[model samples]
Target chain A: MDIIVSQLMTGLSIASILMLVALGLAVIYGVTGVINLAHGEFVMLGAYAAWALQTEFGMGLLASLVPIFIIMAAVGWLVEVLVISRLYDRLLDTILATWGIGVMAQQAVRLAAGGELRYVQMPEPLSKSVTILGATDSAYRLFILFVALALFAVTWVIYRHTNFGLKLRAITQNRAVASSYGINASRIYRLTFAYGAGLAGLAGALVSPLKSVSPEMGTNYVVDAFMVVVLGGTQSLMGTLASSGILGELSGYLAFYSNDTIAKALVLLAIVVLIRFRPQGLFTARVRT
Target chain B: MSGKTKTEIVICAAVCLAILLVPVFMNDSFLLNKYARYLVLGMLAIALSLSWGYAGILNLGQATTFGLGSYCMAMALKLKTIPIHTGPDGLPDFMVWNNVPELPWFWKPFYSTTFGVTAGIVIPLLFAALLGWFMFRGRVTGVYAAITTLAAMVVVQLVIIDQQAYTGGFNGITDLAQFDVAGFAFDAYGSASYYLVAICLTASLFLALAVTKSKAGLIVQAIRDQEDRVRFFGYDVALYKIFIFSVSGAIAGLAGMLYTIVMEFASPTFMGVPLSLSVVIWVAVGGRQSLVGAMLGALIVAGMQGALSESETFLDSWTLVMGLLFVLVVLFLPKGIAGAVETITARFERRDPAPAQQPQRTDAAGAGTHHLESLP
Candidate 1:
């Protein structure tokens, strides 16, 4: 019972992180027809932001979130203005352009930070393993779970009930009509991109303690986030949530049964197989074209 | 053929010949060897262009085919170097270190040079054909193809790194014997290796050119321009996709084979995302529509990389420059360097202008004149 509970905790923790990282990708992809290949770099930039704050200002990871989120969001806004703004209509070209931006971000980080791992000090209160539901796990892991749930709730409310959410969804369905309705689609796109970047930044800041922060760290996470987005049916919020849960738990369970590497390989293989069969993914978004 | 395109063809042939004759002017074996590596990589770029530029398929995991091809040759070369003292049935060094008792049965076929060489090319085709079948049958076209291929790359790389005993794990299969063909030795330091690589690259370029210029090539281009329209015309889009993908994979594998000969080892890095993405960068920068341009792009990019990494000041910023170039090309020069050249030449010299969009249907397969018009 202890092992099963611990496994479930592990699964949920990973699922939460995946959800946090993937949420930004889902949001940006949903609002803007452009697929941001630089989404991973935003996550990386966020982690670096947290690291910079922790090391330079002696700030804790928990304290660094708001500032990091703002800064990364600003970066995202600038990126949209400078690069993504021009390439909105060209989907394939956006991939190439954003990918170029991603590479530039990676190289820029490496040039500034050097090719070495940088660690963030885990907070004193959450440093130790604690018992939850009669099973022991890191206290930090539980905090992340809380953050993920809180984030989901926050995002769900912002998009579902808010006027801004309505504007964003309206533009996504029909840009001209939304503009006809007097919605500033471009302005909304900038905010959506920035908010997505901020969310990614928060995911990075939260995740810094779990692993040593590095430039290349975002690459794997971004790919996983992309998988979530692709498998989640690009425009569906609920799909991202459910797919993240399934993929995370499946890999976590598989790891318990066998090795982590094999678990990862099998998960990828399964996703590929699933993608082959269901190209549109699990749930299709209803957009009025 | 227009006088300008004929000049472009002449320029391409001259560049290849000049690279082939590089040893005469340059005494540096290091320079010669580096050029050889560029040509090998250029072969890969050509292979990528055939599918990506012509068929409108962006196979983001091209390194998978390249790596598989290299590994096949590496296994054979590693087998040849296995000492008799380890016994006739003894495994490679890494396998022994990993406590693998004997040679794995699958590797036994790689013991023969003929079989190993054949398998090196054939396996990648089969792998690509199977992947293409799955992708095309599922209608995983456009960006979905890119996503699936990238995922496939990660999976393949992880598998290679995971199975230590079978694949030599992280370090990969190394210290390969010099590549030989029917007792003709290819010493890394010798002139023969360079010629062999150049010959293969030139042949592959022409072969791809032949393919793109054929009636089949027109059909593939039409499919790229309009998939459903061609499907409506009763062509099996899936079969053509698979065929082109397989051919591209075969050429990539052959390039990998040559790469092993020049580089002297094959590692999991060959199949990693960065190298695979690098192939896309090379093809895109050279103008994907032009085979010769793709080749030159690889050559130029590889050359710049070598120079930049060596210089102390530019070392850190070189990749940044590459990234910047990638973005700039996509935005400002979508047609790439070749497109620039074509336009520049067009302004200076006017001729019987070919249709601005698609080339006219040409029945002649080997007409060098037809080659220039069809390429852009």
Candidate 2:
């Protein structure tokens, strides 16, 4: 019972991280109709940025997040303006181009970090454990959970209540119509792309302390996040969050009993089966563009 | 052959001759060997172009099929030294480490080279056929097909990585021997290996071209351009997709077999997602609609990598350049290097017409539109 609860918590924490990763992917896919294969690479870049700041400036974890997010967001915007802009309507080209970008990013990281997995230093507060619901858990896990939830809340609030959010939603449904209504489609695209990438960066920063930081680490999570986005339906943030949580938990529970590789394969197989049945996704929206 | 086709054949022959003479001119065995490996890689890319460039099936799991071929060859090579009943000294190393009593049932048939080769091509083709039938029959196309294949790649890689006892885990099968054909021992190293790879690559290219020029090839292109229309014409789109997919898988397998011969080892890395993605890039860069373009793309990319890896200044940033090139090509040169070349040459020829008038220009424009409409 104790093991099961502990595993469940771990799963929830991992799911939270997965949600953060998939949210950005979902948003970009929703708005631009571009599957950013390099989306995971952005997360990787953010983690590397945080690591660099921590090492060079000796800054605390919290202090590093701001710079990391800003830098990654800037990079994202540059990518949008320079590369992804031309590939907006062409889905297959965007996939191939971003895949190339991903390879380059991963290799660049390898050159900088020497292909060795680096350990991120957790703050003293985050290194300890706490009791929750009659079960002891790592505080770092709880912190990750809180941060993810907070971000989710922030994203929800931004999307529902803000003008930018309304514009984004409108553009996502139909860019041509949105443009006709005097919303600058290109500007929204650039901002949304950067914002989505920034969220991925934030996800990386949140979990850097938990996992070993490596150049190739993004490849591991990207597929799972893709699965989450696809399973949850590409347009809905709520659907992405829910699906990420469920899939992450299922994967974690399976990993507890079986090997990690098998667990991952099972998750992918489940996603394929789900996709075979429901090509429109589980929680589809009526936004036909 | 028409004069144009004859000219093309001559140019292709000259290029093949130049490639064949590289080992003769180069003193370094490594350089020659690298060229040979590139040829095999080129074969894989050609396979990709046939399916993706011509047929519009973006199979992201090309590496999976390639790995199948490599493992097939590796298994056959392993069986020659090891006894059938007593597998590699009473137990294969991995199974021994995992404490398995007997060889798995699947490993038994791999003892025969014939069976191994057949299984290698058949398995991937069957897998692709089944997958393609399920997806294509249900009318999956474009991005959905790409995602499904990508999923298959991830699943296959995970499976290969997890089945450590049979697969050698991350440390893939090694110490493979040279292939023997009907009791004739063939050296699998140095010049001999290069020749073997060349032969396989040429044969595979010929086979691919034959398929591309056949009636089925025309139908495949028709399906690519208009699937619904093809279906309306009473063509079984699913069967054609599955057939082409199987052929592509077989070609990829053949490339894998040659790859093992040239590299002298096979690892999980050979079949990773990156390589699979790289194959797509190769086809795209070469010109998706042209077989020769696919080969050129693979040759150029692999050659660049070899050169860059040997250089001190640009060793790490090669992929960055390739990535930039990818984005640039997609943005500016959608038809790729070959397409760009064809466009330039056509313009030049148009300027120097042989007594042709305005009628030819209209015909040329009509041809161009036909080509454009055929493109996916």
Candidate 3:
């Protein structure tokens, strides 16, 4: 019973992090119709940003989150204006270009930070453990779960109720019709891309303390996040949440039974098999073209 | 033949001839050895072009086949190495260290040189065929195929790393004996090895070129241009995709075995992400649609890498430079170096009236005829 409770907690924690990462990817890919392979690099850059802020200025990870998000958003904006903006509608070309950007970001970090692993300090107050459902777990893990839920709720409200999101949705449905309605599709795209990138950055910042920060860390995260978004079905926010929960629990349970490596391999194989059956993914909304 | 086809054939012939004659002019064993590795990589680029350029399937896990081939060859060679490197029972050293008392059934077949050679090509071919069957049958195209392949590669890599006893784990298979056939040996630094690589590359180029010119090849190109239309015309699109993917995998496997022979060892990194991405970069730089151009791209980019790594500062920044080049190529040189050459040649040929025989059958015309659909 203890093990089950603890496992459930760990699974939820993992699911929250996966949701955070996949959320940004879903938004970017869903709205823009561009697959940003550099999404992981954005997450990586966020982790680095957190490390720099803490090491250089003694800022706490929690306090540095907003600044890191904004900084990453600006960086994303620049990438959009410079590269992704030009390659719109060219899906394959966009993938290659983003991969190039990812490589450059990784190499640039290696050159700047010297390719060594960096660490981020957890907040002093969140260092304790808490018992939930008769299971003791890290307070920090619970904190991440809280933050993730809060962010998702915030995103849901923005997506469903905000005028900006309405314009973004209009653009997504029909760019020509949306443009005719006086919606600046390009501007919305830029902002949406930036916002999605910023969310990825926040996930990175949150995850930095749990994992060692490195230039190559983004590759793994990107792959995982992609699996989540892909499994959830692109453009489906609710599906991203559900799939992340399913995969997170699946990986957590599998890892508990076997080892981390086997668990990861199994999860990937399962996703591949699932994708083979349903290329549209597990939860695609029914709509007429 | 169209003017473009003529130009491609002439260029391919010149490149093959130049590769064969290099030993005649260059006696430096060190450079000759380096060129041999590049030529083997050139074979890998050709394989990638067949699938990505011709069939329009971007296989991001190409290194999976290459690494599998390398390991197969390495296992066989390891068995033939000096007894000192083996266990008391003559098993590979890593197996002994892991307390594996007997040679596993899988590793046993690799003991025979002929089996190793055949398995190197056949295994990857089968693996790719199985994967391609699932993918194409499921109608997975474009970016989805790329992601699935990438995920599969990572899964394979993780499994290899996890299985320390059979795979040699992270250290990989090393201390292999020289590649030998009966009494004849091909030393790494000798002309024999270089000649073998050169001959294989030339043969592969011809084979690839021949395939590109065949009836099925034309159909494959047509499928790339308009997949649904080809299906409506009663062609089995999935079957052709599977064939090209398997053929490409077989070629990559062969390249991997050659890599193990030339580099003298096989590591898990052989099937790593970086090497796989590098192969794609070479194809992109060379012009993915042209087999000969793709091969040349591999040679040039790999040669540049060798040169860059020779210096400390440049070694660190080489990937950065490559990244920028890839981005620039996508932006301004989408068709790559070969595409540029064709444009220049077409301009010169424009002066002649009716320069081409088949108007609808040119490579560029096919490429320009269709814009790929972005799947939701």
Report the C-alpha lDDT of model 2 over A149-175, residue by residue, as the tens digit. Answer: 888888888888999999989987777
| Weakest 10 consecutive residues of candidate 3 chain A by summed lDDT | A280-289
- Compute the interface RMSD for each candidate structure: 1.1, 1.6, 1.1
CAPRI quality band, candidate 2: medium
- Candidate 1 deviant stretches above 4 angstroms: A285-289, B1-11, B84-88, B350-376
Per-residue CA lDDT of candidate 3, range A129-152, in tens? 999878999999999989988888
lDDT of 1 by residue, A1-289 (tens): 8888988988888899999999999999877867788888898888899889988999988888999989989999999898888877667788889899999999999999887999888888999899977999998988888988888888889999999999988987789999998999889999999999999989988898888888888888888888888778877888889988888888899999999988988988888987888766787744212
Clashing pairs in 2: none
Ranking by TM-score: 3, 1, 2
Docking category of candidate 3: medium
Q: Candidate 1 on B141-252: residue-level lDDT in tens?
A: 8888888888888899999999999998899888788888778999876778889999998888888877887778879888887889899999999989898999999999
Model 3 alpha-carbon miss at residue A29, Å: 1.0
Off by over 4 Å in 2: A111-114, A285-289, B1-11, B20-32, B83-91, B311-313, B354-376
Residue B352 error, candidate 2, Å: 1.9
Estimate, for each residue in B193-238, the C-alpha lDDT of model 2 and write its tens digit.
6777777776777677778777898899999888888999999998
Per-candidate TM-scores read: 0.93, 0.92, 0.95
Task: Flag the better candidate by lDDT, 2 or 3.
Answer: 3
Query: Could you give candidate 3's per-residue lDDT for residues B209-300 as a string of tens digits?
Result: 88888888888898887899899999999999998899899999999999999999999999998889989999999999999889999999
- In terms of TM-score, which candidate is stronger, 1 or 3? 3
